[model samples]
Target: MSVLEIRDLHASVQVSEDELKPILHGVDLTIRSGETHAIMGPNGSGKSTTAYAIAGHPKYKITSGSVTLDGEDVLSMSVDARARAGLFLAMQYPVEVPGVSVANFLRTAKTAIDGEAPKLRTWVKELRTSMEKLGMDPAFAERNVNEGFSGGEKKRHEIVQLELLKPKMAILDETDSGLDIDALREVSQGINRVKDAGSTGLVVITHYTRILRYVQPDFVHVFVAGRIVEEGGKELAEDLEASGYERFVNKVGA
Candidate 1:
């Protein structure tokens, strides 16, 4: 199994005219294939920042430390390069593209990642199957990419993309937000399908333990003040739900 490693990761975001506000401070974690790691924290604790930094977003600059995917420097790769190299980021708020249909967007992504367009006949079958797995309507494929989609619909669409794209590593930022109970179960099942593949490593960033109940994590990390303050097994999530992040926040002096 391959591992994605983050060593002493320190990142900053540009704020003022010439000032940078430090966000992540020395975040270190390793995720191996076939394992799910949950990053749980409060609002403004820099959980999203870590996801963006790992995906090489220009808004967050890595001042020190390294992010490596099986010994390759992920920081050196362009966004598209990172995607093609098997890194996937499912955004908290998926954006809208008015003109591009979901089918076209997904096919284009598959072509780019696989270095060749998949067969139209078989690709359609695969696409429909993926959509069905996510409990999405067959009509969703005809809609514009995330255009006017409800919160649950948008998230389910992302999960469909995740299933079809099949990236080696997935970073899901707040996937549970805005999901109804049914949608949450559907989305969690879709994620578990991907996890069942046994070749992808997953980092699920969430604020609550509800989602963890469906998509169990191998490791539960308590993130406070831009860093992981504590880590343990699935029971940690239960404890957090009962105790809340107050102790962790206080310990970090955040």
Candidate 2:
């Protein structure tokens, strides 16, 4: 079984020549394969910061701490290298690639992650199947990635990659953000499909408890001021929904 260990991870974003904005402050987390971890927090609590830092986005700098995938150093790896090593991030805002078709993008990403090209016939079939399962029109595959797509469509396409790429761990940043009710269910099912396969560890970062209803996370973490202040099971989510984050927010500010 694969394990991802984040120990005292402190990271910052370099916003200016002489200024570095601290985001993740001594965060520690550990998630294993087959485990679903939900990170719920108020905005600016460093939820997405943790996700981007883990994914090795150039904007975030890891000053002190360690991230390991089964004892292998993760912070040392380049962004693409991190991906090649089984880490995937479904961004809060998936970028629009104006020139790259979704079919080409998926295949190229798959090749990069797998170290070889997939046979066109089999790959096409797989891609078509994934798109259909995500409720995407087949023509969407021929269009430029995320361009001219609705917010919900972009989110759904991200899940299509998740289903096809099959990474060791996936960090989803607010995947439910712009999804409508039906789209929410569809995306949640796509996530559950990956989770049920027992291959990819899940770190679902969100601000609300709605997605948790369909995803059924095994652990819930309440992040505040860049640190996890509370950890519990599904009940914690229900509590947060009913009571909100005022208690935890006040504690963090106190």
Candidate 3:
């Protein structure tokens, strides 16, 4: 099984050419294949910062600490290299690639990750099946990447990539943000399908526990002020949903 380990990861966001704003402070996390981890916190809690930093976003620089995927130095790899290493990030806002069709983008990404082109007939069938499973229309394959798509459609498309690429580990940043109830259920099912495959460890970052109801996390981490202050099982998410992060925030500020 694959393993991802984050050790005392401290990172800062580049505010200007010469300025860096620290976000994560000594964050540590570990996830194995077949496990789902949820990082929950209030706004500005460094949750997404952790995701982006681990995924090697240019704006977020790691000041100290190491991130390893299956014992390989993740921080040392380029963004594309990180992806080629079986790491995937479903951004909070998927960008719009106006000229590229969805089919082309997925196939190109899969080819890059696998280092080989998939057979055309097999690829076409798999792509259609994945889109249908995500409740997406077959016509979406012909549309430009996320161009003119609704919020729900964008999120569903990201999950479609997650399914098609089958990365070793995926970091989903606020995937539930713009989804309605029906859309949320469909997206969650897509996630669960990947989880059920018994590979592709998942790290879900969210402000609410709504998504957890469908994609239960094996571990729940309470992130506050750039650090994880509390950790527990699924029940911790329920408590946070009920009690809120007031106490945790107050404690961090205290």
RMSD of each: 1.1, 0.8, 0.6
Model 2, CA-based lDDT: 0.94
Best by lDDT, which number?
Answer: 3
TM-score of each: 0.98, 0.98, 0.99
Clashing residue pairs in candidate 2 (N, C-alpha, C atoms within 3 angstroms): none
Kindly list the per-residue Cα lDDT of model 2 for residues 1-254, writing each as its tens digit.
89999999999988998899998889999999999999999989999999999998888899999999989999889889999999999989999999999999999999999999999999999989888888899799999999999999999999999999999999999999999999999999999999999989999999999999999989999999889999999899999999999999999889
Could you give candidate 3's per-residue lDDT for residues 1-254 as a string of tens digits?
Answer: 99999999999999999999999999999999999999999999999999999988899999999999999999999999999999999999999999999999999999999999999999999999999999999799999999999999999999999999999999999999999999999999999999999999999999999999999999999999999999999999999989999999999999
Query: Which candidate has the highest TM-score of all?
Result: 3
- CA deviation > 4 Å runs, candidate 3: none
lDDT of each: 0.93, 0.94, 0.97
TM-score of 3: 0.99
Worst window of 10 by summed lDDT in candidate 1: 12-21
Residue 192 displacement (Å), model 3: 0.2
**What is residue 54's positional error in candidate 2, in angstroms?**
0.8
